[model samples]
Target: MTFQPLEQALHEAIDWMLRLEHLPASDPAHLAFEHWHAHCAENRLAWQRVNGVLDSALANLQGLPGQAQVASRALRALANPPRRQLLGKGLALLLLGAGSVSVLNRLAPVADLLADARTATGERKTLQLADGSRLSLNARSAADIRFDTQQRRVVLRAGDLQVQVEPDLARPLIVATAHGEVRALGTRFMVRQESERCLVSVQQHSVLLSTADGSARRVEAGQAFAFDRRGSMAVAPSMRTRDDWVHGRIEARDEPLGELVEALRPYYGGLLRISPQAAQVRVFGTFLVDDIERTLASLGETLPIRVDTLGFWLTRIDVK
Candidate 1:
């Protein structure tokens, strides 16, 4: 299912809500909002959904003194031009609260919703394909499966995957990302799609890694490779710990703190921000992916860093 239209509708509904918040029923914008709400069924549904979330959030705040004033202040802050870029982030923190399913729905990528297989935040899923191959998806991951008489393909939309291929010379298994493809020559391997590159780790046998530019390299078992559309390079062997997420843990071998934070983001329900200096801090240890707070607390104890958490909505890490 494609969520593009619905996503657009939801965004428009939010815009309308913000606009109408300070406008009277007699305002010209009210007429425009009415037209937009009546434009289509999707608009109506999005409006209802957005209002439902806001109502729930308001109810949650009802116990506080001057609840109406608090909400009004938050909405007005969101309307500021300087803070416009933070509209989503601010709302997620101040109004939506933490771990709101509505927030997740708004933040999730359209491609993820349309994927043939996907896992939600902090969730892992395993699948046995029609060809007897086993596939494991990491947190916040998505992929599309395409199988035919000719080839077996899994397109990684985002995040990481580990697969144990069923031997079939007749139909080669290939994992593709925006950067390139990893053709499994043997069985077990892992693939991760990063912002600017794709990472491949071979666990059982060798796989042929190819870039979008037609460059190719053979990555042997126990080796890891990283590549973008332009070129490829060998990553540190220890980096193969990329698949460690499958075990609900991360084994950082003197890795940068930013890498560890990136790994933890998918598992975290709300915003997790780290300063550049803190991110550069070298980390070496094992951390649990499922328990973000505990892991972060452990890090804070061991590293020269400060961790500030605002309920469950946000956690900010900085160099101490």
Candidate 2:
């Protein structure tokens, strides 16, 4: 998502335009939005390119109607409403659906129809990787998977990994992580390429985790754990399933506060400051990791702690 300075300025202006919704029309938000739009050739070019406002509106109305209804209603709104109301709602929707519209049309070579997915810092994602097998990448991670006849492979450009495998008679899927590699031969597993180590866990089928040094381990299902540059450790039942966070929940059996907070960081952005006062709090319930603000509110209710906002979506925990 590289952007030129003009593009960046345009993005900032778009934010102001959207924020105008909270102010009185007399405040001149629309006027400001227009002024910025006409600031220079570059500004206008950037404004024409940023169509995120439209993307958001369309995403919000995904199942209700297609883009045609939206286009017609927008024209209709411009025709029927007062100058103020029409500009307010119509401009917002117009901007939302129009993100990168011109840029996309011009840069046709760079279009991605695949809903590009992302993982935040310390955030991980586990998804069924086409072959009925599953792959999970650690926080600050990304991978593009494609399954073909020759082999099923995952190219892990960054982050730690843990995988669960479903075998196919054709070829065992291989994981290529930064540290090294792991090849599965009918196995259930977890593999994490931590800062220095590539941990591999085999839950049911067999998996071979061969390090760069030529050392290897064959792990089994229910026997779950990690491996790195140092060595392999005992597989614990507790580490067997940390897969729930992606689906919006984390069911813990007395996990530590630090671990819980680390698990919750990806669902929310910005600093999630956990005061040392909560360093040792033991959590043992299922948490809704999705609506992180609501999760924080829930934490405030269940524990003697308060979630105080520090803006920029930053939050801190204080003893209630």
Candidate 3:
């Protein structure tokens, strides 16, 4: 069928883009790419279509107020990965050709770039709001803070944040996400936005959580809760230990290898693949954020796993 042929072409186009995205202009790959691009009219058309989609997405992101510079830098980084390859790992292999458009839609790269405050991959930032409240963002996080006479609100567009509310009885402090809103009642809490739900962990005082459907609950201190548009779920006792990332490390406590790999993804500027067996293996340790390669090597040494590295932007974990 025509659909089958077009799908194959799209897959090929995606593969080609990934290969050439991080390659140097003078590399032999470019010569090969040029030949491939000019080989047939269909190939040319596919290339043009792919490029058009990326350009349009980039342009749309750049149009956001005060986001032009950040979006340009982010897009350029995606195009030309760094030689050290720190945090640019996820998109290349996972998002192939038209798939890139879908990834863009899900991640909302423009919204993150345009956020009032944002932290790049493997980077954390602390901000002091106008109301004297403290906001700490985790790596690869984005938040928009809007303060007016009516309320002090922070919209968590992506990732996680820890907020220490400054007591202001006149104006309530609220944190909003895709799932719902958490109203701070002189509380300190952390909100992490996962795929379909948001996790709210209250550390001090209590927070009033309201779902999209008008259901509400007061999450007290020492509790961790998750909620989506539908409603809030059961609450669990809070962890006595703090998030290790706050201390510039990742602490894995009998965690699946895949979970650790995902946690490390934001710090790696490469494509990483974990075999099914490798992902199922359990790991526990503290990995220094700055030494990701060493951490991976340690995994290979201690477990029945192999860490395979191919060039600056490719790594794979397979069963030994």
lDDT score, candidate 3, position 124? 66
Quick one: ranking by TM-score, best first? 1, 3, 2
Tens digits of per-residue lDDT, candidate 1, 30-71, equal: 888889999998899878877767556556544445544444
Q: Which 10-residue window in model 2 sums to the lowest lDDT?
A: 104-113
In candidate 3, what are the lDDT values of residues 17-131, reduced to their tens digit? 7678768788998888888888776677667655555555555544456765675465455422331132123233232333443334332345677678876555667899999
- Please list the C-alpha lDDT of all candidates, in the order they appear: 0.76, 0.55, 0.72
Give me the overall lDDT of model 2: 0.55
Q: Which segments of candidate 1 are over 4 A away from where they belong? A: 1-51, 54-102, 105-108, 238-241
The number of the candidate with the highest lDDT is: 1
For the record, the alpha-carbon RMSD of candidate 1 to the native fold, in angstroms, is: 14.2
- State TM-scores per candidate: 0.69, 0.57, 0.68
Error of 2 at 170 (Å): 5.2
- Backbone clashes counted, model 1: 0
Q: Whose lDDT is higher: candidate 1's or candidate 2's?
A: 1
Could you tell which candidate, 2 or 3, scores higher by lDDT?
3
Off by over 4 Å in 3: 1-68, 73-111, 235-242
